[model samples]
Target: MAAKPVILQNKACTATYTTRGGALVDFRLQPGGINPLQFRHREKSKGSKEVFFNGHFVCLGNWGDPSAGEATRGHVKHGDFNRLQWLSSQKERQALLSAYSTLEGLYMERNVALDENAAVLQVTETVQNLHTVGRLYNLVQHPTIAAPFLDGETIVDCNATKGFDYAFPQFSENICKTWPCANAFDGETINLSSPDRAYSSVFSFLVNPADEWGWVTAYSPAQQTLLGYVWRRSDYPWISHWLHFEGELIRYRGLEFGTTGLHKPINEIWGKGLVSLLGESTCRFIDTGDTHHRSYLSFLHPLPKGFQGVKQVEVKDNVLVLTEKNTDHTIKISHQFKTKYAIQQ
Candidate 1:
């Protein structure tokens, strides 16, 4: 059976989710406007093979490819979560989706709630071990942002100490820990926040040891709007910067936040002293009937013109604060829920 799409909305936004893999296909502002998220980066596929190029999807079980010819062992690229089906239901401003992946021996459930007349999306998710033995898993939220919302004048603001190129060994093996500063393969100092500094595409991490919480904000001065995400570091210790660009033909960045820091499979990441890049390790040993929970929140707020960048963003006393990086401009928003991560290890 074809997995039907589920829609949830409030006054400020509308979200669409697919029962297959529980991917959020669309999230846009109301009453009607373009999706803040980009989609269909390429033409249709010619076969049954799937592409991770969708607007937004979740990666699980395995962050990357499985071991060679291990399909019989339920190994699939990025996990079967995106390849499996989920059961869904909704009530008013909230929606619930749940599924069981026999391949991964895990059951996952997600609840999304949109507050009335608010521009916030609260997401809560739980993962349970259904198998008698333990298993290693990787989970990431892949939200790629692109045009009419992305431009060279756009700015990325976040607090991270060091950065490492994910795939380019020439750069990864040598880049400095000065953060957002990297020596390209050609000895050029590239600014990680610049959308135009891409070199053959790369995967990188915003390495941090924050146990309280973490956040990253993207400001589109062109649209006079800002988008951001807040999560707990104990649940997700790393934020990944995915850069890909080739002139006007393609340019998109994945402000990815998730469990594992390394984008490789379990074998490459498990017990390999890869924690520096693997972000806190999504590798967990769960016996039968054990459950784990992780949650995060996303928001889209309008910004004033000429807002170049942000210097600080913190959820203090349930108030979201944004202090401009180079000026005296500041924006504060009061909300109901705290930005703190609910479940702490």
Candidate 2:
């Protein structure tokens, strides 16, 4: 039998994490509000099959399709963490879960803690290589949002810079394009910040090298609510925008940020050697017995009447300040993270 899901609650929010894949199955504002992270249970039949992409699950070891040899060997897409069970325990408003990836020889531990006075969740993940040899790995936070909260009017905001379409034959900087303006599969340019566009594609953008922080937000005008995430730029330098629609209607949107943006295999990313153009390593390296840590926060803010989308998000004195677009209004939320990986002042 599978273990029970862990529930963490505070005065401002309630979060539920399932041990099945250590996925954040549900997160909602206090007093019964609509949960925006409702994306769950979709069958993925490619490579090793039987895997499902669910709500807010971490893509460990890798991001996309494995090499042909790796796939033939029964390797799953986006790593085995999402397809395997995890050990979990919770105390009060915090939950701790751990899972080991046999294929990657890496052990990952995650700590999910909720703020007592705000609808904020701080997630810290640490991975240690248990193998005897050094290896390259990628970790992506895949927080997908779906309907009831996601629609044609939803607006996405971020600080991403130059980016490229994933359909490109190779990951090259020569084809890099500015953010919010990307080439659709139909050979037309469209603004990627809105879900109303008539295209289904993926785009990746690099963070400004000088910026210490990176953030991505999605606001639902009709719902009068917004969901956002913030992380250290040094930790997660790339954000991938995935838009899926059906017959002029939006279906799902993925606000993914992580160590790697390229969705190819290890051989394709490292063997191709495009670090000079990326200005950063496309894959992270970990030696035996060494551990790597990353931290990020997801929060929900109640939007006021006549409020616009997010124009800017900043971390100011342990608080998350969001400024509205085309307006001077700003919303502040408590964002004090109790972890060593917290962003420094």
- For every candidate in turn, the CA RMSD to the true structure comes to 3.1, 2.2
Which 10-residue window in model 2 sums to the lowest lDDT? 336-345
| Model 1 lDDT tens row, 206-282 | 54565366778887877777888877767776677776667644377778877765667677665466644523454
TM-score of model 2 (CA atoms): 0.94
Question: RMSD of candidate 1 to the true fold?
Answer: 3.1
For candidate 2, the per-residue lDDT at 298 reads: 91
What is residue 101's positional error in candidate 2, in angstroms? 1.2
Q: Could you say which candidate leads in lDDT? A: 2
Q: Which residue pairs clash within candidate 2?
A: none
Runs of candidate 1 exceeding 4 Å displacement = 1-3, 41-48, 72-74, 169-176, 248-250, 275-282, 338-341
Off by over 4 Å in 2: 338-345
Q: How close is candidate 1 to the true structure, as a TM-score?
A: 0.87
Superposed Cα deviation of residue 283, candidate 2 (Å): 0.9
